[model samples]
Target: MEAHHSEIRILKEIAELLNEGTEINGLLSEVLAKLLHVTGLSSGWIFLVEPDGKHMLAAKENLPHALAYNDCEPMCTGDCWCLDRYNNGRLQKATNIIECKRIESALAMKREDTNGLTHHATIPLRAGNEKFGILNVGAPNKTHFEPEELALLESIAFQIGTALKRIKLIEVEQETALTAERNRLARDLHDSVSQLLFSLRLTARGGAEMTADKETKETFTYIQDLAQEALSEMRALIWQLRPRGLENGITSALLDYGQMLGLKVEPEVSGVISLPGKVEEALWRIGQEALANCKKHSGQEKVLLRLSMEAHQVEMLISDCGNGFYYDDKQGEIPTLGLQSMKKRAEHLKGQFKLKSSPDKGTTIQIIIPV
Candidate 1:
């Protein structure tokens, strides 16, 4: 009876944590810590698997030195029994994996401390037919888990899985709403501000052509030029919101945008154009920014854009042979807001950004993103 009550208390605390509605990462970390405290487990971690079968270490608590080495590099990558079983649809419940492959490898290498941990209980987190990922909990010298322990873990895993599904649905709905708003704004800009700018430019041109006085004609010409510049800027903004040509592919869309900016875009693409939606969107935005920068800053009218696709990653390079300013690479600082924005877009997708520039040698921007 006492053990059953303890289990109930654990469930109650965990249920409360799940109900707190915190961010997923923070909620998972807090729940893992709470579980460890109540169950006396030495360490625990959670993996959130994407629909494409890629798994990420969502949360961890009290990792042993062996697995925590190199910034937990071991845990972040590589395949093990639990993951293999999970991927194969065999890990349906809480059970003890034969042994922790990561720990075994760490021990064999003798590079970092394992703190005597050799085994763990792996629980598949699922809600109905949907499988989110796995929850792993273990302790020093605890090679196997009892039935009661596994049952408790299974119950908690169910709650976590349901919460994950709810959160993901919410995210999808929010994204859909945001996309709708962007389209609406783009339409409004095209119909209102864009048309007004075009009309203003036409009126200024007519005034310049009709005026008799030289000074009045010059003033009208200046107005016409300013209106034309504003119209170009407005068109760029509208394109960013809608990205009308993106349906075909990122490369094609980028080529069209570069042409719109009056730059000679020399594009070289390798491998298939298929990419994840988020990655494709990010790359498209980054490419647009790079091309816009080339048109505005680079003295040359031509730019080279290269896209390479590999099994695990994609690379994009944009370069121009123009009068370039000296860039101080030693400090690793981005000199312009445009570059900073591009860097942030790449990093937000867990990718890399590199920039190189020198006087008379021109500038090169490279971005690599894992898909």
Candidate 2:
């Protein structure tokens, strides 16, 4: 009766380990140790079946196989006895398996060394529709495994197989969620900012052409200047809208990027500007974007930018001599996301912005950010 109760307790413990919420490695190790204790065996191993149904030794104790680990027990099928027994749907023992026909004729041990192991029992590990692997215990004693002991080991192998399946499902779910987030970011960038930049560029090109007209050349020049000024502002807006969190304060950052793009920026600050931190950040980003546009599209050699503070607000002014673009009130003209972002940022802080430019003349952007 005492022996019966002990087996029952060990079986329950194995079941709990298989179903536990802990990590997979921890649970498997506990299962292996408990199985050895329950069977009163000193040597054993767990085998994993590869996709091809070949048996690979995964875990072992008190003896060494090529693949044995406390943390990992990867196994391949077709070569090991444990895998063969799992495919045949039986928990089998081979105390002196060299005498069995299946072990002698079916296994390739006829050419391999036999002293590595003389006695071992193999139990099939099954979960759902598939046989995952095998559990094996061995000893020098030929009669070490009894009929009742083999039955108990099979039950433990079945439970472990189910745990592996659940782990794979969890990994798939996490991968799906990561893919979804990347897709959403791609869509947002294309729809909002990309379309606006394309339309704004067309509008600028039209203005540049009109400045070459004979009758209204001067008027077209003015329009061209305003268009370019607006272009720079729009570019500033897009940088702020960027999700990657580009960092720069309006004055110094503007100078840095301008230098990179083959332009000189002589920036000056005065009157101790004391705007809110985010407002300063937005203005700096706007200035940097404006400088970037000038290098890329303005056709200018040098720009002068100045920042100063008033009683209640801080102001920024950027001036550049560059080919100008005409301003049109066309209804279908697209807005650049960068400029929209700048406008939104300015409006958010209840600040004011002013832009000035022309074809032969220069361009200037003035922003007043409140404290």
Candidate 3:
């Protein structure tokens, strides 16, 4: 009865994790971590085929509290035995670590190549016809993984691996769609606004001799300057329209957005919280909105943008020296589209976002989210 109850409880927890709005890594980490608790293993992890197919991404277990993916680095293609099996399409296990000689040998090569990994069991992880990566179990004790334990780990890996593959495919589709939209926007800018700017410049230069009165000449010059300023803004927009590829992970996106977001207020930027591009894009959008508000309504000369990883979540804070306002005071009162968009974005991520400001004080926004 006791054993049966434990199994039931474990399944419930697994189900809950699956239902949560966690990314692939988080879900897998939970599955593996629970299995480790039940089987009494020291450590476990999930791995995935690096998107480029050149190496493997050492994924984390979906535990309640654990290491961030950025804190964990992946092994190279030729270095991981797990990747070799995943690439070669095979699931391997070694009972007593010694009995699994062939796999252990391959793993040892990987270990030497990686400098070393703690003792572990390498199981090929997959979904349908595709191989994701591998599930590995590690313990300080040499004889920690028995045949039964290995079987359980492999079973867990099977289910988790399949789910991971599905999630990753969805992510790819999203990224592709985003890239297409960005490119389409870029084309529109280049064809329409860019062409218009060129024409305006030419027209201004050609008509320079049309007016000889000093005031008339000054008016024409002012119009030309306005056109030039409009052109500059359009050029910046065009740069953003060029979609960054999948290779630009969360850290890269954060860095890129930091520069752009800080341009107006010249905020002090620090620490980078890196995740996938999707997460980064969301963060960047929120940052963009915050900076826009600061410039438009906050009446502040400078703002601060900070990004960092704390516990299992990513944190971003944007504060400016301006009259502070209550977050809910104008909840249904003011109809600012930019602030609405930022709040909506935070809600979408299952995160928390807040804005505190006053009429004569300053504004501070803090956004906390899980990656």
Candidate 4:
């Protein structure tokens, strides 16, 4: 069985890649490419479950049309019939989707690009009771999968599922370690540095008030002011490290942060501020990032923040009336790293994120996440 030998080789390659800590996207792409090559399939794709559990994210796809068209990804924009069924809990194993509704429907509309694609098979990537996502492989005008081929595909899917689980575990471990380190640093700063700074400020103030000589009094006054500023900065740093009152809610914590930053943050609320812990945490981090960006680049201290909660969703908007960048510029023309990071944070929560900006107009950042 040359085919069996090839399958084993592919699995080994994937295992080696995992050991090297290859990113999930790259790992999926390589695995899909290898599987398509070995099985002589027309195309393949991988869909991973997002954090929200309500949406399936199209992680990687290698298709003939996409490759021919410079990797155009329509799959990322719309959901296909196969995915619809999968989301509805119909997909449980390696199963053939006869006359894939997506491809067939496209063919019916005389879309020439979908030619020869009649069906595909979906294999659920799962680890026992935990299901992660799906691995899909399609053939040209093929409506069924052979038993042996299906078995090999299932085996590959299982391997992928185990790898995904391992990656998830690694991420959780890293995040836990990071949080613990932050707490330790926060405690040290608050108990040692902050207290010392407070004492120094008080002593400097007393010395300045009691001094008789003009020059000596001025020197003590300067020291008192410097120590006071240092204490304030230290408290701000500690707040960031371990966000005090975050457990109570984000509203109060954000207001306090704005006060620390010497910014007039106008808040507008529409509904209940209650939210899940993860949702609150994401919002807190996003708020911090947005405020930091404003302080660094906005050229204005006042900012407007709005939080709205509807029956099924939560929305946040942070706007600043300051110098804005050109949003209509072509690729590589605009600074996008921060914007991309904020968008990623929202997407990680299965939310919609947008930034609006113009040369003279101000910038507005908005995120709407379904609860």
Instruction: Show the colliding residue pairs in model 1.
Output: none
- lDDT rank order: 1, 4, 3, 2
Report the C-alpha lDDT of model 4 over 212-279, residue by residue, as the tens digit.
Answer: 99999999999989998899889878887899878777877777787678888998988998996567
lDDT of 4 at 15: 67
TM-score: model 2 vs. ground truth: 0.44
**Root-mean-square deviation per candidate:** 3.0, 23.4, 14.3, 4.5
Give the TM-score ranking, best first. Answer: 1, 4, 3, 2
Q: Which runs of model 1 end up more than 4 angstroms from their true locations?
A: 1-9, 49-56, 65-81, 84-90, 101-116, 127-132, 327-331
Per-model TM-score, in order, reads 0.86, 0.44, 0.49, 0.77
Highest TM-score model number? 1
| Distance from true location, Cα of 192 in model 3, Å | 5.4
Error of 1 at 85 (Å): 4.4
lDDT of each: 0.90, 0.60, 0.61, 0.77
* Tens digit per residue, CA lDDT, model 1, 1-371: 99999999999999898888647899899999998998999999999886557899999999998898789899999998998899988888998655889999998897558887899999999999999999999998998898888999999999999988888788778877887899999999999999999999999999999999999999999999999999999999988998988999999899999999999999999988788877888899999999998888888999999999997789999999997879987888999998999999999888999999998999999999988
Choose 3 or 4, whichever is better by TM-score: 4
